[model samples]
Target chain A: MLKYFEQLGHKLIEWITIAREFIRLFFETVFWLIVGPFKDKPVNFKSLFFQMVFMGVNSIIIVFFVTFFTGVVLAMQAAPQLDKMGAVIYVSSLVSISICRELGPVLTALVIAGRIGAAITAEIGSMKVNEQIEALETMAISPVRYLVAPKFLALVIMLPCLTIIGDASGIFGGYVVGTTSLKINAGLYLQTTWKFLSRKDIYTGLSKSVVFAMIIALVGAYQGLKTKGGAVGVGRATTISVVTSFILIIIADCILTGIYFFSDM
Target chain B: MPEKEIAISIQNLTKILGGRKVLDNVSFDIYRGEIFVIMGGSGHGKSTLLRNMTGALIPDSGKILFNGQDLLKLSVAERERVQRRFGMSFQSSALLDFLNVEENVSLPLVEHTKLSPKVIDIISKMKLSLVGLQGFEKYYPSELSGGMRKRAGLARAIAMDPEVVFYDEPTAGLDPVVCAVVDQLILDLTRKLKLTSIVVTHNMESVFRIADRIAMVFKGKVEQIGTREEIRNSKNPIVQQFIKGELEGPIQIT
Candidate 1:
């Protein structure tokens, strides 16, 4: 028991240090974002554009399919149960609410955590190993501004855009299921979705996308900048970054949902 | 050159990595407009000291004084302002693989300089030509041979005409012919650009050929620093072992 507590204490301290580093990278990235335009180098539009295309444009197809199938699956499972209760019409309400308030942002964030988060960590980790990041420093270029800033700003903008798309794709998938498979009235399905869904729900979900984006960016950058060893170290960083981003996204989702539930947002 | 102004003064800079003293109270002065090489065996602290000099790695203690400023003591913004004129060549070249040679060479200017694109282009070409990489401007770093990649990196390093250029093992993995070419290039460019150079290398031949002076690091400490003649005729056992590539010496075989 004593040894267990000792190990627990060590792990706790390790996690605390990691969290500290993560927060530092988060604030540093944000500070770079605010001051980026005033510097001699200014904002790197070329890299920023590339990052948006990489993170948002490239992620659309996978996000669409994942959310689409998810919507289909959600409707398939929930509709039958609701239909047995003589409340088949409520399926639209359930689908729309889940997609807008939870599924869209959360699923999109998870997919992005697996995809873009891994890529960011690997790319920066490789740069660190090769000393390109240090080369940037010696040249007076903050790796944060040149590397993390573009990706951070791009993801902060793009994750929401992807979430909006995912929300639409999911609803469409649910609509298809409702009309064809579930045999619900099309007009009623549309009407029910419109009646139940409010701007607050959609706004809340989209806002979660912004937080999730920052988490992914910060976790990836922190792991990457702290990477040592070499290629093997980069692989480890990529793995840890994805896992940490996923965990943070889920935990953040729960916290935000609890806040909205209690605070009337 | 009689006054021999100090370009960089490292005062007892120490760095501990994983509990090992990577840079143990290293102190040296790189004179203005000369080729200064830091030589050591593989595990010694030459490269670490070079990293410290570049202001990329803050030491556990001591100071790296450059341009009337201590690099370790400055804020991030201030360090970057001072680093604007610095240049570094990495062991693996470290050129952006996605960018072509010309683009890599022009990165510093494009990011920092207010020069017109047309003028930047001309300067990029000139710097590439100086490194004998003019014809390979369109070739990406991945496509270039090892020697050619090093040349391209050097082209980029000197593109800004930086006051102090740091070269980390400029000819680590190359043939004798390529190594000679690299040595010649370093000599020619440092002279032509009138820039002070701090080179970290364990290559004895390269050091004797290119260095105006040499600082030999042994077991994480600076063992000896002097002119080529002084170092060549030094009484230090570890320095003699390192420079001569001998196994039988005061340095314990790990």
Candidate 2:
């Protein structure tokens, strides 16, 4: 019985060690990515533009559709409950605050994880398997500077932008549901939502997005860079990256929520 | 010139894998402008030795001197700088599938040099032309045949005008005519560029066609080093067996 317990303890320790190494690599990659563009060499604007289009601009449609449905669902659920209490006017306010503070950022991150994270992993992993990364190294070009830094900057700058769009679209979605489905006054719904929503709530959503962007970019790039074997290896890395980024974003959202609520209290 | 002026010198190099010595205390020197071929049977540590020379693998114990500087002692940055002086072609012809032929050829120049895009493009086109791939620049790797991909890889290798170029099985997995074209390209490039070339191949025909000197690796050691005529006419039974393509000999096929 003691041997079995000891074996379990050993396995747990091994898992912890692996997790710690992964975290260390994550932060180290972030540190280099932040400092890379500011170094002696001039920044490659062309690469940066490509990354922005790839990571940010391309993700807009998905973000719009997701946030829109979320808002519609929120209004549909809240109207009947609030109508029973003679507080149907508060439904818009509830949708606004919930979407802006939590739902928008979290859902956008999940979508981007599947989209951007998978793309980065497949791209980098294929490069590894093909020796394109080694080819870059052999040319005296830093792969981190050329490949990773641009993607990191693009994600950091774009995730917040995406969240803002998501927040606005979600409010618009709520307005649609309130006016059409709930037979609420459109002007009254918009005015109550604007009055109830504060800058703090919007800022919280954008802040969570920044952290999610870091996690997605770092995890995706790490898995891609470390890919081994060949096609099968790249496929495995991409799957792991998407799944891991999704889980990390949720955990980060929960922790940030706890801090935001408790600290205010 | 004295032997000490060798371009590359390896001493007591060893690499262990799975509790067995893949390379055991192997040592050799390559001259400044000679074609050095490391010929061996498959899995005879030939490619491993080439990778070690290029600083892609760290040996368990050894010293590698390039231009009399200890390559193993350099920092990663310093080693990368040294590595830039050479070019490498892989056995798999590892071309970037996303890039067209011209873009793939122009990669090293775009990464390392301050040349304008126009000049880079022109030079890339010239490289493709040099490799007999003039009309194929706009095509992707998938669009090209296997032989064309190998030639495209060669174009990329010489894109930087490297001092030393390493070829890992340049003629493997190709028909005889394609193999001859690749071999001829190796010879032409060596002569025209005056580059120090090291090729790891088991193809005897390729060795005869391009090698200025051949170093046959056997059981993790250099079994012989000689000119084409000397290797062909030598009385060494192992060399004789290998040249004759015999399945039975001192070489154990496991």
Candidate 3:
């Protein structure tokens, strides 16, 4: 029993250490960004813009197409249940609320985490292993300011943009299902979507997106920066970065959503 | 014997990594305008010592005095001011893979100075020429040969006209001709630029060719340090075994 308690205590300490380090990294990245323009920034913004494009514009088609398909699935599932209650007309409201409030930001964040998070971790981890980070330091450069800050800023901007696109595509998907398949009045569908979905839903989704963006970039960069060993270590960091970002995005979504849910109640 | 001015004075430096004493009570002084080589067997803390000297790794205890001022006690901005006097070339070259050669060389110049692009370009070209890599300006690091990559790394290191340049295993993974070329470059840079060179390597031939003085690290301590001729004539059997590469002696081949 003593051994069991000791092991549990050790595990708890381990997690706390990880969390503490992550929070420190988060603030350092934020501090660099807040003072970025005033500092002697040798940041490669051209590369950052390209990465932002990769994170935002490149993911557009796939994100929209995937969310469009999901909207169709949501409508299909909802039509039967609402129809049995003689309320098939509410499907447009149901789909719009679900996509804007829940699916849009959450799904976009998950996909971006899987795609770009792995890349950030691998790139930074490779640099860390190669002594490039130390080289930068010896050059009087802050790796956080030079590397992580640009990534954080770019992703924070891009994820919200991608989330908005996901929102539009999903709503359009619902439109198609409700009008052509369900034979609901097109005008009525539009009215219901607009009526049920307020600016708050859209704003909150984008806010969630911004929060998710910070999580993914910071988590990925943190894992990458802490990487030791060589090739195998870099590969492991990439995997952990993706997994951690995914889990954190979900947890953040739930906590934010719960706060809003309760306040609205 | 004429006394030389100390460029860097290291005092009883000790560093522990993962509970292992990689650097233990090591002390030495590298004179100005001299190529000081730290040589040892693998896993023997030679590179660790170099890292400590370059301020990349802070020792658990001890002082690194650059021209008599303690490097470890300075504020962040002040330390960076002190650090700007250093340039470190890694074993792998560690060039930013995304950047072209000229861009990589121009990095420090652009970061630390307000010089115009035309001037930065000219200086970068000059440094590259010094390293014998003049025409390869547009090529990325990947397009260069292993030796060319090392040259470019050296070019970048000296970009800021730093007082001290640290080279970690400069001739590793290169042909003998290329090794000789790198050695010649180190000698030329030390003479022409008057920059202090602290090199860490196990390549004994390179050491003898380039070192003005040598420090042999054994078991995390500076077991022996002397001029090349003195080290050659020393009666230390372990040092002799290392320089001779004999499997018959004290060092256990792991």
RMSD to the hidden true structure, all candidates: 2.0, 2.7, 1.3
DockQ per candidate, 2 decimals:
0.77, 0.51, 0.83
Residue-level lDDT tens digits of model 3 in B94-151: 9988889999999888888999999999999999999988899999999999999999
Supply the DockQ value of model 2. 0.51
Stretch of 10 with least lDDT, candidate 2 chain A: A34-43
* Model 1 misplaced regions, further than 4 Å: A1-6, B67-69, B73-75
The runs of at least 3 residues in candidate 3 whose Cα sits more than 4 Å from the true structure, single-residue gaps closed, are A42-44
Q: Which tens-of-lDDT digit does each residue in A116-137 have in candidate 2?
A: 9999899999999988887666
Question: Model 1, chain B: what is the TM-score?
Answer: 0.97
Q: After superposition, how far is residue B163 of candidate 1 from its true place, in Å?
A: 1.4
Q: State the TM-score of the second chain for every model.
A: 0.97, 0.96, 0.98
Per-residue lDDT tens digits of candidate 1, residues B190-240? 898899998999888999999999998888998889999999999998888
Candidate with best DockQ: 3
Which residue pairs clash in candidate 1? none
Off by over 4 Å in 2: A1-43, B1-5, B17-20, B233-240
